[model samples]
Each structure stands twice: as structure tokens, then as C-alpha cells.
Target: MTAQIENTGPLTTEAGAPVADNQNSETAGSGGPVLVQDQLLLEKLAHFNRERIPERVVHARGAGAYGTFTVTADVTKYTRAKFLSEIGKETEVFLRFSTVAGNLGAADAVRDPRGFAVKFYTEEGNYDLVGNNTPVFFIKDAIKFPDFIHTQKRDPYTGSQEADNVWDFWSLSPESTHQVTWLFGDRGIPASYRHMDGFGSHTFQWNNEAGEVFWVKYHFKTDQGIKCLTQDEADVLAGKDPDSHQRDLRESIERGDYPSWTVGVQIMPAAEAANYRFNPFDLTKVWPHADYPVIEIGKLELNRNPQNIFAEVEQSIFSPHHFVPGIGPSPDKMLQGRLFAYGDAHRYRVGINADQLPVNRPHATEARSHGRDGFMYDGRHGGAKNYEPNSFGGPNETGRALWQPVPVAGTTGDIPAPSHAEDNDFVQAGNLYRLMTEEEKGRLIDNLAGFIAKVSRDDIVKRAIENFRQADEDYGRRLEAAVKALRG
Candidate 1:
């Protein structure tokens, strides 16, 4: 426990000086302007002015909670991460659920991908599983990420989200087919955060104790089961109760109806990835269950809420690079970009001392670093040696990396990923569409048409339809007919 300072008196200034009166500011005379030397008054005003920070560029609207992850199976054979070493092992966790394309004050029920990021404060360190509710993403390459997000955001000229901007981008980036299909489907708007599934979405790596490696994907099946809101329902709920999802999540935990998920993973041998018919590391696709079934590993449950939302939840940060021994990054382009992008965003958004915060700090172990002060740095290292390989007994590295060396062969150049036989982007999206029921298919077409019909140019609408048609003839035909019906 941290040392607590005993309070013996009443109101005091931030510097611990006793305050004479909080109600009125010091003045030269009655009706005279207040003196500029009132330190308490200055402190209050200064602090109030600095209350807000820059909100996240994406996933701005969010809700989070404290939870426990209990290993229900032995995953040591697959990975050396201590948290998953044995059955019944428990680790503390914090999970943040969010909407992708919205501001901090946006409605919680909007039709957008939900961020399903989790921070596991394990014994080795904090391992963050930063993911989303959907299994696939819009684009495969990080180079297109900013452009893709720009389309989803407000238009530069119109000052509002335009169907023209959105369709123009999606139509040009054919790789977005799979995710667009998933987005405008029946599960587009989740009924509540608890009633949906979560996925790592990107391929990751798992190295066993014997030096054997595997490609891995994660799935968190909600124990609460799948439930969703229709387009009509979401439209009404977004206006009537913008905080509907956040409120439900908070109240559910408070009333003892704690939400939980069954954690699982699909593992593929490293050797198989090269010949897997499709790029397993592609962020816009998925490994079929017929090839690699999901193996149940553990249970994740949220049982506690933060006392201070700003201190704990708002300041909480995550990055895919936060991994323990045996778990490491994959060659997924999006994941590679995220490893750097996430930490940099947090450094600027929170502070260089963001990790020092109680919410983001490792729970089971103290993080020792030779780093010195920056903005609001606590100076925890004291007068210790800053440089490595020093004569002084500084906190030196173990001379071993937490992650294994990744083999590199081909000369790096500006080229697309090495293609596999079934590498076309439309396949998985077509498969997803075919898997839907008749009613679900009708709704999907209607959803697509509703927005597609709003586009001003016929070329943009045709290009968008052509991408879906490449995925499936019937899907494209139905969508085209729906758009015509809506437009005419």
C-alpha cells in the first residue's frame, strides 16, 4: 500500500498551504479588482484551464472496467507467457470497449466497429491484446490507414460525413470488401457491448519453450451470447439515449450481472503459413475454422468499475507491442504500424510518463528504467546511472530479448505481399455473405443501398457495386436493385 498523508485540518491550497477563505478572492478594497498575487485563485484557474487532453484520433468514445482472466486450460505447450502457464492461474485485466468513428461525445449505439482492447497486468509485465469486435479490418496495408479513416471522418469541404467521400475511398480500395460486408451486416450495431464477440483481428506469433513457433489468432466469445440492433433501432436509440451501451455495461457490472467471455485461439504451424493458399498475416482476411479450429483457453470477466473515470479509464493506454516472453509480433502490416503508432499516440496524448500512471502500470512487478524527467515525470530513478554498460550497478539488461529473432531473407523493396493461390480479397467477404440467412442477406443489401443511394456520382456507386459483385454475383445484383429502388 502507498503511504497516506494524515490530514489534521481543513481546506488547503495545492501546495498544502492552509487557505483563509475559499469563497472570496483577496481585493484591494470593496468593489476593487482582485489582486493578481492570490496564489490559490491562480492555481484553481490554471488547473481548470488544463483539465482536458487531446482525445484519441480513433476509438474516442469508450467504456472500461477492471476484471480477472483465469486460465482454464494449459496453454504452456503453445506459449511460454506465464499468465497462461497453468490451469486456474488468474491475472488482473482492464478492458476498454469503444466506437471507431466518433468523438468522445458521440452516440454509443452508432454503426461502427467497436474497439475491444484488453490490458493484462501479468507477472512478467503488462501484455496488451489490442483488438476490435470485428474479425477483419477495412484495409490490409497501414499506408492506406489514414486515407481510409479520413473517409469515415467528416468531409474536408462539406464539414460533414458524405456518402460521396466514403464510397469514393471504399470503391477505390477493393481490399476493403470483406470488412465493408461485415460492417453493413446484421451485426453492424451491437445491442450492447456485452452481447458481442471480440477478436485480436490481426495475426500474432507464439513461440513455445522448445523453440517451435506458430501463427496465432484470438477470439473472445461472449458468454452473454450474440445480440444486435437493427438500423432503425440504432437510429432511434442514438437520439433517445446516446449513452445506452455505456450505461448498460456500467449498470450490468454494478448490479452483479457481470459480463464474461470465453477466450479462445486458432494456432497454425509456422511452416503452414507460407503454403496456406492465402496470406495468413493479411489483416483483411481470416483463417478458416475448417483449417484451424479455435481452442478454448480461458475465461475473461469484468467485475469492478473505476472510482474515477478520468484517472483510471481515460488515461489507460494499450499497444500490441506490450507482450511477455514467448508471445511476439507477427508480419501483419497493420500490426507492425500499430506497434509504433499506438505508443507514440499515447506518449503525446497522455505524457512521456504515461506508463507511470497507476492504471497503466504493471500490477505484479515494478517497472525499472533509467529514464529521467519529462513533462510531469515523477523522477522515480533518482540519481541512478542513465547510460547502459556502466561501472555503477545500474539496472542493466539481461542481454536477452523477450521476443525471438524473426528471420529475414528477401531484400526490402516497395512491393505488395507475396501472393498465394487464393489471395483475392473478395473470397472471404463472399463466403461471409453466403453464410448469412435469407433475412440477413436482405438487411445487408438494404443497409448498403441506404448509404450507396446517397452518393452523387453514378460512377462511385457502380464501382462499389462491382467490388461486391466480384465477391458474389447475387450479392451485387441484389445490392444494385436495392440502390435503384431507393434512388428511383
Candidate 2:
């Protein structure tokens, strides 16, 4: 038999030339200062200085894995996306799970919403489904995003998170009522990344080959079941092992205990949006199952752990703008803003050629565009025409017709306004409150009161109580009582 080949190679500089010595810098004379002409030392130090990219403003702490998504049902009548067109079709995917408001070293078990973003490598292109653990978000409009995130972060003066800061913003923004209730509930602190559910959170549009359009919402229910930590349990985990979630995910995968989720979608006919009880595009609400039942589509299973955290996880970028054919955006204000924000943030943090990074690169199809010449450009388009409408046989557009646009009859301006007549903010929140069990409602009240009681400002506390009152009388009364008792 032929000798087994070993691919061991010598170390070299980034320029690919073999290095003579890596352990020492060039010196002027024996025991003298290092020489400035040492190109290897200069190059090594320069690269080390820039080895780290800017961390994400949010979702900074994350863990990722490689997986496969297999379609179990056919929904071709609603969408023409090739990846979901046939049962048994499989798409390779990279999924990143993160804590939304945490830093790179923050405790994973802290009470916070988790990010569940997936990059699907399909024949059409890469489709990124960037979502969160919670089905509803804190605010509906993108204008409130920065301010809202600020509240979730540290106080400028104190350099630490203050209850006053968080409560003041939430109380002032009544749209936050629905999500606040969810946040303080048991689901706020997931037991592990494998045990929580994931949602698209925003309504999306799906178009069939016949040109029929339908509104859609995605839900990934964890096969491991919904498990959450009590405040006491989470606090203990935070102190004992801040990286508990990351360790659990990595160890489980290594032990061959892969986690999985059932993929389902709630689809609404395009024309019915006009007459729907609530705005279909509202990120703060969910489509009631009575009206639109979930249709089972596929399953997502994470079977492999990433070999390199920075290369496969940190450099991977997911954006709402990344979509395959027949799958498009909706009028959700938050989603609309994210289509631009996510990509822009990636470019700024990871470099203009972020898409060329191995983890973020498209595996199924080559990306074609007129864009060229940026930092770390990778020089892939050798001798290819860089512009459209050229005599040279460059890549041409598909010439496909655009999706049908919904009619718009409102005055357009920079100011944000309600999208529908029934856009009352408190109704769905009240409905959600009433849907919970007695024990859960009690826990929610206790959680909210405990957090709000820490706010020094009475006015903020009262304003927050009023918003809760609008959601449900019992909810507000219990919270008010709980806060008073805590103060006593």
C-alpha cells in the first residue's frame, strides 16, 4: 500500500513566503535594539493589532453550529423558493444563538431575549432568517430602536444598568407593554440554547410560481422542549458559570446529542391583510392560530460544532435583506429598517468585503454584482467586466418581473404613524396577559414589581403601572400590590 500522506507544512508570513525565524526579531547588533528593517516582525505586529473586528452593538455574545434543514412538507402553493419546494430537500445552514443586550463576556443565563439567526445555503442563494427567541419585540418602529437599546444598556453616568433608565423608557413607550410582559415572564431566562423557541418575529411575504402572494410568519419550536430557569437558578448559574449556555451547547453536540427544532409557518392570504383584525405586519403581535394555523414545513438540527469560534461564528453575518427568490419582505417597520441596518453594520464591523468571509460566503451560488475594490476585496473577479450594460459578455440580469406591490394611499413623510385603524396597542397585550395561567401571571407580576421597585423615581413607577393597567386590571393591581409590599 502507498504510504499515508501527511499534509504538515512550514509556517509562513501572510505573503506565503516561508519564514526563516519566527521566534526572534532582527537586531542591530548583539543585545542591541531591534532593527526597523525587520519586515516579518513589522507585518506580524500590524496584523495582531487588527486581528479583532469590532464587536456587534447588540448580540455580541453568541455560540454557533453547523446544521442541515430538511423539508418535511411541501408548501409550493404559497412559495416558489427552491429550498422549500419539495419534501425531503435539505439545505446546509449555520445558526448563531446569542444574548441580545450582552457584551462578549456577559453571563449567558441572564434574563434577556436570545437571538436565533440562521443562514440557509440554498441553490438560489443564501437566505438569512434573523430572529429572536420572543415572538413579539419591544417596539414596532425602527426610530425607537437606538433609544430602546440604550435603555437596555448601561447608564452613561453610572456605567452600569439602572432600573430607572429601563423603566423610564418602557413606561413612556406604551408599545413596549406586550413585550415587557413576555420579558419578565418565565421564558425570559432560557435554561439553555437548545431548550428555547425561535421566531421570525416579523411578517414576511411569500410568492408562488403562479405569482400568488401570501403573508408568512416563521416559528422554530425546539424539539428539546421549552425549558427556562427561575430567577434563583439563573442567578446561581450566572455566578457559578457565566458561559453555561455555550458550554452546554458545545458539550452536547460533542457527545452526539444534537439539538433540533420543528419548523412551521403561519401563512395568511395576501388579500386578507386589508381586512385582518390587526395589522399583519406588526412585529409586536402574533397571528392567532384560530385565524391562521401553523403548517409544518421542515426540521432544523444542529449536528456539528464549529471548529473555530472567530472564523465560523464571529465572522458569520446574517441579515434580513438576504433572501432567495419568491421570498421577500413585508411592510413591518422594524423589518424594513433592519434590511438596511444589518448589512451596513456588518460592512462597518467586518469590512466592506464581509460577504467574502468563508462563513458568510455563499456556498450554493456565486454572488454577482458590479461592486468592486474595497478592503480585503479577495481579488476574485479577475479580468471580469466591472460594470453593467457593457459590450463585454459580463453577467446579465435575470430580467424577471418584480413582485406585485400592495396599494398605498397615505401621505408619506419622515414622521412615524399608525398603519391601521385598529392599531390599539393595549388589546393584544391584554389578550396575552389573560392567556397565561394563574401561576404564570403571578410570577410575571412579581418579576415586574421586583425590577420596577428598584427605580428611584416614583413617577416612572406610576407610569409603568398605568401601562400594565391598560393591559389587564388584575395584572396592574397585582403588580401595584407587589411593589407596595416590597417597599414595605
Candidate 3:
């Protein structure tokens, strides 16, 4: 008798255990219907049913692409970040564009803040620049964040966003006036994500090998040029084709006409930040180009579309905390809050092993750590020591690899930053008002009043006009007139 050879493919199973039956399920008989007690069948169905996790709380509607970031100019003097060290070294990157204040099912063309986040797979590690198109944000402190977001989201009672509720909050919180103006202006509704600029809204820190630190703000200017839709046009598009932006991105990549952007940074010396005219750490303000000019650093291009939207895009995680060797966080309160909140949210939504997912996995270097399996961790570290300080050879700590230490000079307590003369939020916002041309100012007032008039309370509208009045007398007067006209 010939020796029977059993065929065995790579040993695999539902969870990598070897399976005995390939086709048949546990049953009463060979010809009988499958039994509920079939462990394999139950495992398969259970896994499939719970495959998807909760979507993002915000920026839920988004798309992603793979690309390369090439250093176009020398920026090594300011940052020791390896990706920007070489003049022409190309670093692999994954970029995602999203709309804030919209649910996963919401329209893409809505008047919302477009999230322009990028994850660079650098040799050091994955560095995430989680940002938005605009340079400024709505609120400065993390305390007001939930309230601010509530205004943008749907009404808790009606399940629909009410302009009255939105304007009510904005009027009460005058600090939001700056970002609110940007939201209703010509660039409010971007024609598509490709045609808008992306900014590292919060100032970040860059440290060189010399241990010299500089505050930096990133500006990714789209090569496609800035394009925006009129309010009427955006409204029609939102109703006509809600998925217009998402479709445009997918179609453009499929045709091989990749979108590109020039990455630039406005660098400020650390010593100068304390004496700058405006509060540099404030998230609701912008550092003017006249004081600190933007210097080009590199170029970002998106050429590859994701094969699986769910696994590649939906599960793809990005956080401001994911910094490489040289880049570090600033004193910006919003950025500090996000450094904790984002990673925490990802852990809750995607699990601790989310970094192992194909989309979020580091491509430039091996993710060597003592971290073992949590929920879905599948022995990524094979035969490797799972503890540090082991006599056996393992990853060792490098003290010199640490980033530049920022000077902290206040009593260590649960109190806020000491309020300086520049603590008032209205100054820079007023400066932005005065900078606008006559026509631009007119449009600004009209837009502000148009949105504010929707608030049912005249007293609240008056309060909002007073806040604008504090910025510029003429600005407040014009807005007041417009609101009155809106009421009439």
C-alpha cells in the first residue's frame, strides 16, 4: 500500500489554530443541516458580525490616499526630523481629508471645517500632523470644547442642527467670532478637499540635534489652487450630490492625475514667542506672515487610492501624539488636550493594537516595543523578550534621543496658565477685522449678521453685535445694521 500523504497548507485557523475540518460543520449526520453547536461556524459568524467598530465622533466622513513627501528645501537647521533632514529624500505618507461636524452619512459639501491630516511613515517612526484647512480654531481652552462642538452638531431635542442654537452659542462665546467669520466667508465651503490649504492649526515644536528648539506652524498649500463654492452653489450641491467631494477624490486618483501640495512652515524662535505681539499659543488666533514668513520645506502628493475603504481608510488612525524623534508638542492648550484625547479615543474605538492594522502600521521602521497582545494583537513579536531591562539583548533606551525640553516656570498645580496682558482674545480678532478691505469687511459684517439674526433673541443678537463692536466700531455698526435689516 502506498503511504498516504496528508496535504497541509500553512497551519492556520479562525485565530491561527490548526483546523481539522475544511468544509463540513458539526451536525447530527453527514446529510443533515448544520448544528448550532458548530464552533467553527459560530466563530466565523461572530467575527463577521462584529468586524466593524464605531466611526469617528467627528471627521467621520473622510477618504485617504498613499503618497510620498519629498524634501524640496533644507530645513534641517530648524528640525532634526529625519524626513526633512535630506534635501530630496522621499518619505512614504498616508493623507486623509475629512469634514468636521458631519456624521458618517452626512454630505461632503456641507459648510464645515475640512480635516487635512497627514501621517508620514518616516524612518524614525510615524509622525501625524493632525490639522485642518484653517490656521485658527474656534476655542482656545479645552473646557469650552464640548459646548463649541454642541453648537456645530445637531440639536439634542430635534435631531437637526438649528441656526438659532448655533448663533446663540457663538454670540455668548465671543472668542469664536474669528473662526466663525472664516466659516461663513468665501472659503467656507471648499469646492473639494484637494483645492484647499491645510494648516497645523496648533503651533508645534521642532528641535535640532544641537538641542535648539523652534516653534513651527505647517502650511500645506494645494497645487490644485484654492477653490470654493458660493453659499447657494454649496446648498444646491449638498442637496443634489452629497458625496461630491468623496467622488471627486476617488475619480481623480483612478485617472492617475494625482493631487499635490507644497509643505511649508512658519518657524519662530522659542525666545521670541514670549515677547511676540499676539499670544502665540492661542488656538483661536494666527501668526501673521509679516512677522514670521513661511518657508517651503517639502512637497506632498497623493497618487494611490486605498483598495479596501473600511480596512484602509475607516480603520486608519492618526493622532497628534504620534510624533517622530525631533518633533514635539507646544504649550498650546488645545494641542495639549488633543495629545491625550485623540490617543484615548482611538484606543476606545479601535483597541490598543490599532497600530498593527495595515493602514496604520509603520512602513519605514519596525515597531519594536515590549507591548504584547491586548485584544487583536497576534504575536507581532515572535520569540522576542516581552520585558525591558532584560539581560538578553533587546531594545535599549537612548537618552540622547529625547526631544528638547521646554521651560516650564510656574507653580505646579491644577491652575491655568498665568494670565498675561495679552490674554484678552479680542485683540488679534480685531486686527484681522481691520486688515480686511472695505468690500471684504462689508461681506464679513453681512455674513456675521446673516447668521446671527437667525437667533430668536434680539438681546443675544445685540450682545453679539457688541462683541463685534469691541473689535471695531465700524464693524459692529455695520453688522448691527445688517442684523436689523435681516429682522425687518
Candidate 4:
């Protein structure tokens, strides 16, 4: 049946009083100066002036959509998360795709890692799978995160990203080799948000109903098939249309060509983590697919574009720490750091009451917390018990709130140490280099040389080459030759 439009009586003010003269302001006489009593004119100007919030420190440029995640395979044996309990169970989701290092106005086609963050508004709670396009990060420790981001951003002196600053940090940090290789490869410049893969880069713990724990990594393989722009195509697009990715996503959804991903997870038995070939919790590394094959779990489809970009996308926040009952954090230092940093950044960027916002609020369940008044709070828990541990019975703690006990053996200290088997930073990087096909290896060499040639410091170039040399002699030689040619 075709639905007819029902007309609302008239436009009204925030107080629900009918606005008689919305177009004109009150005045002492006709054509006279506007009067101070014009509340409509005053309110419009005031609200317009305060409309913008501070742009995100990173992942500032993004596009978002409303979607549904349906479980295709039962994952209850691995995770007790209610959303994954039964096949065909659907959970509402919001996904925001972004370019990591870019500002709000930066081009979408730049050679950079993309942010792939998803919020699952489940019956239990909001579960945020905050991740990136790549499976590994540039650093394993959260302590280096700020420094690494600084290198990716503008140089303090020039107000522009400097090649020297970027390579200097990466060269000194051998652990960055794996991610650097990925960043300079074909996948770095994704053709659009629809075609690239998404990953929960950090290994996460999934507790089953049986009280057993398994480590898992999430992978969202794009059903559109992997597509990327070469350096030339990306350069041209950057100049032609900076908002290409955003427009592509919006228009595709509007035309009913919805994009989807096949959700899969690589699960490792908790006991095997101790004896794994590489540190299972290392953020800079990946658990080889051969060792732990990804089990198909679900499908995520984006069918609706957001109505308000600022309210739904810009204000949306995702934190790795926001986990439900079955999901928990691993010992990855980067993930641990993010558990605090992401939430703190959101509080500063979007205000403390961000969760109460419509875009962030859980749809299937009402949030019950003793969190009282804060800026922009919706006052949902009015006149309720403000403090916990009270006899008044506010929100009681659940038995599931307790995290599964993880064995701890390392001494608490700030010293930099490699504590796991095959933890040497260069081994995995070398293995990745060897895994690339001949054509890919050639492109990787050219990409590294192209950027390294712009770095003015010879010592930094030499140091970077040394790291590559340790990875593979042929890889180092080809890069060195290419850099020398470009330099000459």
C-alpha cells in the first residue's frame, strides 16, 4: 500500500509553541531595527554558531551507515555473546569508514590505512569492534602510538608531513617493518571504502558459556572483491575529488546497491598461545591463516545511509574497551593502551554524555548506570539512586561483569624487552617479504624507494635499508638501487 504524507500543523519553537512569524523578527515598527525580544531570531543564530564539535584527532574524515549484522554460523562454542548465539540472529550496527592520518578535508584516495570501526548495538550492550583495514599495526606498544602518529602527521616546523620524520621513526623501530610493507603495497590505496577488507587487528579474548577462553581476530572480507588504485590513479583522484569515497558510499546505498562483508574469525585455543611461533598478542604481527583458519561466522550489510552526518557519523565514537559479556581484551600492549585512550579521546572530543546521543544509544536494551549529571545528559535516570553500593538498589552488578582470570608472570617495569618466542621484530617482516609474489615485491621496492628518496637524511635512509636488509637481501638491494637512481 502506498502511504500518503500526513501534514504536521506548523513549525514550532523548541518549547512546542507555534511559530507565527518564523521568517521575520519582531521590531518596534515596520523596517525599524530588530527588537531584543525576538526569541526565534536569537535562538536560530545561537544554535547555528554552536553547531560544530571539535574534529577527531585522527580518523576525522569518515562516512557512516546504518546496517544489520546477521549470524550465518553459530559461534556460541567460541563466544557467549548473545548476538552470536543463534544462526540468523540479527543485530543493528553502525559502521564508520575513515582515512586514518587525514584531516576532515583530506582526500579519500591517499596512500594510508583506513579506519573500519563497527558498533554492534546488541541486547546485552554496545560492542564496538574498532579496527583498521590492515591486520597489523606499525607498533606493538601503546607507548609508541603518539610518537608514531606524530610522524604520520605534519612536521612541527613545516606544517606538512615530512618524509624524513616518517622514515626516521619507522627505520628506528624495526617492529614497523611488517606494517610498512603493507602500507607501501597495492592494498594501501583502497579504491573505495566498499572494496577493502577490515580487521580487528588486535587479538581479542572470547569466553564461552563453558568458561573456556579462546583468542580470536575478526576479519570482514568485502563481498565487492578487493580493489585498489595505483599511485597514479590515486594522485589523479586526490586532485579531482577529495570526497570520492564518501560520495561512493552514499550514492551506492541510495541506489540500493548495498555493500556487504563476510564476517570471519580466526580462533586459537588459549593453551596454544603460550607455545605459538610468534607472540599471539602482538599488535604488529598476525597469526598466520595456515596456523588458525578463519571460521565463517556472519554477514554485515550496510543498507541505510545516515540522515545527519554530524549527528550520526561525526559524533559517533567506538572504543575497543567497550566489550559485552563474552568479549574481553587481550594482553596486546596497543589494545590495552587503546582501552583507555579511545574512551578518553571521545570524552574530550564529544563530551562526557556522548553515549546518550541517539546515534550511540543501544537500541535493543536500555542503559542502566549510576552516572549522574554531565554536560548534555538526557536525564534518563532522574531522581534515581546516584551512587552504587547503596541499599536503594540502583543498577546492580552482574556475575558476568567479572573478567576471566588471565595468568600473569612478567615483572611490572618500563624496560623494553622481547618476552615471547620468535619475538625478534625482523623475522615476521622477512617472512612477509618472502611471501609476496615477484610482481608485488617489485612494486613494494619501488614504493619504499619513492618515499625514502624524499627523506633528506642519508643516515636515516641507510638505517632504513639496514632494516630491509635484515628482512631480505634482495629486498634491500632492490630498494637501495631504486633510491639511488631516484636520488641521482
Q: Per-model C-alpha lDDT, please?
A: 0.92, 0.91, 0.85, 0.91
Give me the candidate number with maximum TM-score: 1
Candidate 1 regions exceeding 4 Å error are 1-9
Per-residue lDDT tens digits for candidate 4, residues 383-448, read: 888887778867787756524678988688895635577777777778988989999998889888
lDDT (Cα, tens digit) per residue for candidate 1, span 1-488: 13357987988898888899999998889989999998899999999999989999999899999999999988888888888999999999999999999999999988899999999999989999999999999988888888988999998888889999999999998999999999999989999999999999999899888878888999999999999999999999999999999899989988899999999999998889889988998999999999899999999999998777788878999988899988999989999999999999999999999998999999988897777789988878888888887899877788756666778797878778767889997999999999999999999999999999999999999999999999999999999999999999
Q: Which ten-residue region of model 2 has the weakest summed lDDT?
A: 399-408
**lDDT (Cα, tens digit) per residue for candidate 3, span 86-177:** 88999999999999889888998877899998999988889999999999988887777778788888898989887777877777887787
Clashes of each: 0, 0, 0, 0
Residue-wise C-alpha lDDT for candidate 2, range 331-350, written one tens digit per residue: 89999999999999999999
Candidate 3: list runs displaced more than 4 Å. 1-48, 413-423, 437-439
TM-score of each: 0.97, 0.95, 0.90, 0.94
Assess the local accuracy of residue 331 in candidate 2 as a C-alpha lDDT between 0 and 100: 83
Better of 1 and 3 by TM-score: 1
Top lDDT hit: 1
